[model samples]
Target chain A: MSETNELKVREKQEVAPSAELTKPGPVFTPHVDIFETDNSLTLLVDMPGVKADDLNVDLRDDILTLTGDAKPSLATPGEKIYGEYETGRYYRQFSLSEVIAQDKIDAKLSDGVLRLTLPKVEKATPRRIMVQVD
Target chain B: MIYRTLFGAPGRRFGASLKELEEMQQRMDRLFNGFRDRSAGRVGVGAGVFPAINISEDTGAYYVSAELPGVTSADLEINVTANQLTLAGERKISKEAADARYHRREREAGRFSRALALPGDIDADNVKAGLADGVLTITIPKAEKAKPRQITVQ
Candidate 1:
């Protein structure tokens, strides 16, 4: 790896408790990258150890909520000797703007990463307005 | 995960009130979230390591696991020699369009190298690794001489 390509380590941060949750476990705020194009917004969420059936993505009243539980699927049975990380669930929420088409949003989970595509509302799509001359 | 259940280290207990206090602190942190640059993954505080790892041991082998979300096996390189295990990989995330506007950018992409010293010698030829659900798990069996043998209590 080149000097510039060296990856700096960043510890995982837990999501602050903002509401009453029944589940009991450390909930991490998954890392995410969000970008927008002319017609849609793309969100890439990193959620390692979470399976497709264990993830939940909900959008209600313009609020988008994501939750996933990380379970040990690989059989690496042994006594704990040392641990640099703790297993836990992931939770995050984002309030969408009016431009997003909440009903048209789509989500896919692959290799522990969740990709969400949120298409814009029809009238919100960006387009150049041509001037009409007299 | 089984590790979560196995993490009952001695002397760390949280009573009901203490748990409530933790929740209160978390709520306060969110209140002042704007003051901190939370958009960058590099700035967040937690365990303070990239691709957090865990190690476990059985009578005959040692198991090591690391989180590498969105990273494929093709990008990773693992080497074990004597008692050291070196994990080197480049995490390549698809780049956004040049004109694409970003609302929030936290996930990062780059090369990372981590070398861990094992507790005992390993059978390098018998080492096995697998990547599933973005987690890389390596099982390293101990060398014949490194394995502890129980003598018959004659």
Candidate 2:
């Protein structure tokens, strides 16, 4: 019951609070997934409807920014469509911690998917030691 | 007589042959134009369409690669079912102020999904995925029977 109440509250908050209220401005938001492996941390971002030449990735002052644009589909006059997916530019930002290796980060974009590989610093990775017995 | 046999009647033969010849010419023109368009770099999903991918058996593991240019690792979802592999996610637009006007927008956006049928059955529990430089590389180790083995001779 409490959970349902909370969800209802959330839904209410998302709805417009009043009539004549201005619509919110467009936001630059991108969905991202992070995974960690033995060697590196990988990030995959989807930037569909975007071309390679229009993407930009940068890391500045511990903040990583990814920005790109997506082209809209061509619409003919008097054409009737029944979908509500909008294509536009994409923007996302991430604040990095000291644990991340800033200098060795690698990024690539292909087929509308962006991938980032961040290798851990030497001191951050686990080291195995061999023990010998006499 | 020949016209009657060719078109099922005498008067309609010329018209039918003319229409047939026009269609054949149109088809030939389309074929040539398609070749020319491809040579001009207009093939396979145009400028913003993502690349279609296929994974083949490589050594001891399954290799997966997808063409996702201008995308980073932060925007991907990969899942493996019993015998199917699914890649689904969205790419957002670049963030700018509300008043910014785009002159030439040509990137793909919104959600995209790709599913692959594995060549051989795999252990979904052990599947692994990696993304580097806009390419997603998934490595699925072959099952016990699927892996190559050497028999002993007595």
Candidate 3:
């Protein structure tokens, strides 16, 4: 009876390990500040080490992908006595809802910051109705 | 009696002399000029502090490009370790003036660093870097195992 219980426990652990492996890896969420205006939604993403030429923003179907690379700051080989930040490639993805107008989306990168302007679809925006008096 | 009443003492006479006053004025003028010279070059671009880089991937390799306008080839450094790539440089602006009045100066001058971690593992040894038209380009070839391969069906 004890042998059967041990086998069941082992099988359960193995199944959990596989399940975890199939899950998505950790997402490197960029620091983003979103603002909604009358005509569009402005998204500002802080890509500190990124350069304007290196940034790529793509929208396909409902998914938006942001990819870029950042170069290191030191030229000659020296002892890195103190360092906190890890400079590397940046990747982020976001799923947009139907309210977004894909065709009107515009993006710009300046000074390592990426700004995306997402316009809402006409029908998605709120409309004002006129009232007439008889 | 008149010299004693007017000059008082030798030290006082020296301090109140025209030559001494001229020397003190020159020292004060030098201090003020130094302050003006330092403050004249203070131009700050608050939101403009990041380098620009471009990256693209093909079937076999990944390409990255960056705009380093004032950076010289000797000032730039590129390194690739495992799947990470970094580009770092220092931008120094040295201005000499014989008799030039400043109208307006707006340029970033300081040390700048940028780094990017690649998505997939790359062959570090095969990476190549080049600079053209103030833009630096780096090509990182994908590893054999990391490259996409077509499998044949038996």
Candidate 4:
């Protein structure tokens, strides 16, 4: 096994209890990766076992909240011998900056990963103005 | 924390006293394991956590599920031996532009391999595996000799 390429297993981070729970189970904060380009900011969120219809993405007053309900996959419950992780809903929030065009944001979910693209406003995009010499 | 065998067996749900004991045992296990995890200096860092798994069994088969967000069927490889099941896969995150600046990066991309010792002999020919929503579920049927048989009382 290559030491550098080995996958490091991290336990899921549970959402803080300070957040009010709308549902009855443990909620976890999904891991996320955010990057910004010249035109837009992209967020990749990992929420395994969540279906597209069960996910809710809400944005208001520069606060973006993501909630996904992940149902148990087993149709028939069996004797659980060993479990490393528990099934729960995923919840997280991020406050956006003024430069982001909230209305123009786009979201897509595929294979348990949610990708959000927030386009920058025209004023915030970098533009090079050519100097004219008469 | 390392995984532990859950207390209480099938059909024990009606035993309230046993159920309470199970819950108490679970709480105590967590309390002590939390200390062990911290002392090992692996708390929060998750030194060996990857593709978290859950193993369970019914009368006829054993089931194993792994959480592998963002991984597709094309990147996974599954192999089962007489007493072991091996999962090997690679996760790839699309590359962004050269000028892209990362605000936070927690998702990872790489190859990972894990081999588990199955509890009983597996009917390798009939094992079923499927990947959906980035989670992989493997259904391993127990071998004929390993499966429980109901013997009539003579």
Candidate 5:
């Protein structure tokens, strides 16, 4: 209820991609903040270099997959002095429960953070039952 | 135009504290050990993760980008000396819910400082810092003498 954008941040599970193929570069599992409200679940993922055009979020057979390529700004005109960080792609996926209204999922990206909203079904939300007079 | 500083001996590296030095050593080990666990996409060490940075330079400026997923611009501070750049920041734990429990906890929250010696003089006046998503980018313009110049032979 405290979420203003209708995205209640909650707890969710995620794992990195496990494809056997050799990825050209390092693939990072983005850090995410998942929240849930009475009606929906929201996920806030950190993907700094990933742009809107390069991002892909997919849902298939109750599995939600997220993959994106971050264009490395590591390229510079001057000779290399030093490097300490690794740059590559961002990928993560999560499984949705049956109570989730998967079709109404929404995703938005801003300032490198991806916010995803997955609404819950009407049966999943709590409703107060009225007491009958005896 | 000075390449010596690139290999300059650490006549002193920003006076690291005891705790910072320990963290720095762990980072070096992580690099050498090549603990790139394909499954977790991270080193198994919980508290040994150092916010790695890439520092590079062009004709005009020196650029530095640090990987800081949860850190915001307001939580960070950037300082530029004659030949040093220091980035200080803190990552805080979200306290929105008190009943939440983490299944697999890897990320941590704490203060971090990365002090790097610049390869050249900094313009100081035109230094720009920006935070996009979770990455902090700092562009420090090279001093007048450091900018590459082409001279003609007549």
Candidate 6:
């Protein structure tokens, strides 16, 4: 929480078929699951068809951003018979809270889920103080 | 008939929100108002639940993809017939933590099934499926006659 107000997350609708999208092609906002544990916050994002090499997860100034560029898997040599689902890019961002240990963020991708774990700092955890009897 | 089914048995269904009723009222008003918005010619929308999908076609094959975040490959099942394709899957919720509480939950977990009628000339043997980043992509090759062919002038 800071003096400058910023939304924790924002989803841009870049794939409206009525030509409301400004980009050249469609770019979907990947859905994410954010779960808070005692020690860390786990984020699981879905970005199908996105290889590890094409994904970029960056953190700058407490703002964490995820960008993935996926090739058109539907662009096959065979002639088209029926179709649904377009191939496009993916983007998602989150404002990391100060209680997290920024340096120790861990990320993993498997079976289309991008898991990012942001561990809490020492100060954020609870501590016990012994009573002093005089 | 829809109105009768949704709200017809008024005493049976209770506690529906005013906003939802108002939206339904507006839809009813549009239906009975007798004024057609010819300018905005759009297809009728489907029931608002479940994932949304799109379909496209080419000369040689068919492509279909479904948005299934939080669903694993093992949870998915696909079936292809001579003129039909079926996708059925379930998204399971994690139960690892006994004391975990949610402040907000937007993602839903449930079983979803969608079926589409494929053209009769589908080559079922060459169908391929891949799941990545929560999306399911299926490629089905068309029959020999369905593929594009060219003729040369002598």
Model 5 superposed RMSD (Cα): 13.0
Residue range B8-79, candidate 4, lDDT tens digits:
453565586788999999999999998896463233433255677888899899988888998899889999
Q: How far off is residue B48 in model 3, in Å?
A: 8.6
| Local accuracy of candidate 6 as per-residue lDDT tens digits, A1-134 | 22222112123244444335565666777766777877777777777667788899888888888988776653444443333344578887778775677789898877666778888787635778999999
Interface RMSD for each of the candidates: 4.3, 16.8, 24.2, 4.0, 9.2, 10.2
- Chain B TM-score, candidate 3? 0.64
Question: Candidate 3 or 4, higher TM-score?
Answer: 4
> Model 1's CAPRI class?
acceptable
Per-candidate DockQ vs. reference: 0.31, 0.05, 0.01, 0.39, 0.23, 0.18
Model no. 2, DockQ: 0.05
Candidate 2 lDDT over residue span B34-125, tens digit each: 79854642233322323344344654667655545554567778889877888776645555335433332334446567666776777788
Summarize candidate 1's per-residue lDDT along A1-134 as a digit string, tens digits. Answer: 23237677766787768887787767899999998888888899999889888999888888888988998555367987776666688989998885777778899887778999999887835888999999
Question: What is candidate 3's CAPRI-style docking category based on DockQ?
Answer: incorrect
Instruction: Report the lDDT tens digits of candidate 1 across residue range B1-154.
Output: 6766656542354465588899999988986673554332122333455666788899899999988988899989999999999999888888678877988878888888888899999999989999988888999999999999999998
The sequence of per-residue lDDT tens digits that candidate 5 reaches over residues A53-118 is 889988888888888778765333364455554567888888876466767988988666777788
Ranking by DockQ: 4, 1, 5, 6, 2, 3
* Residue A64 local lDDT, model 6: 87
The interface RMSD value for candidate 2 stands at 16.8
| Model 3, span B22-65: residue lDDT tens | 99899999998768744542212212324544466776778776
Chain B structural similarity (TM-score) per candidate: 0.66, 0.60, 0.64, 0.69, 0.66, 0.66
Per-candidate Cα lDDT values, in order, are 0.82, 0.57, 0.59, 0.82, 0.68, 0.66
Best by DockQ: 4
Model 4, residue B15: distance off in Å is 40
Flag the better candidate by DockQ, 3 or 5.
Answer: 5
Q: After TM-score superposition, what is the CA distance of residue B6 in candidate 6 from its true location, in Å?
A: 54
| Candidate 1, RMSD to the unseen true structure | 14.1
lDDT of 6 at A17: 47
Per-model TM values vs. the true structure: 0.76, 0.38, 0.37, 0.78, 0.65, 0.64
Candidate 5 CAPRI grade? incorrect
lDDT (Cα, 0-100) at A125 in candidate 5: 55
Model 6 DockQ (Cα-based): 0.18
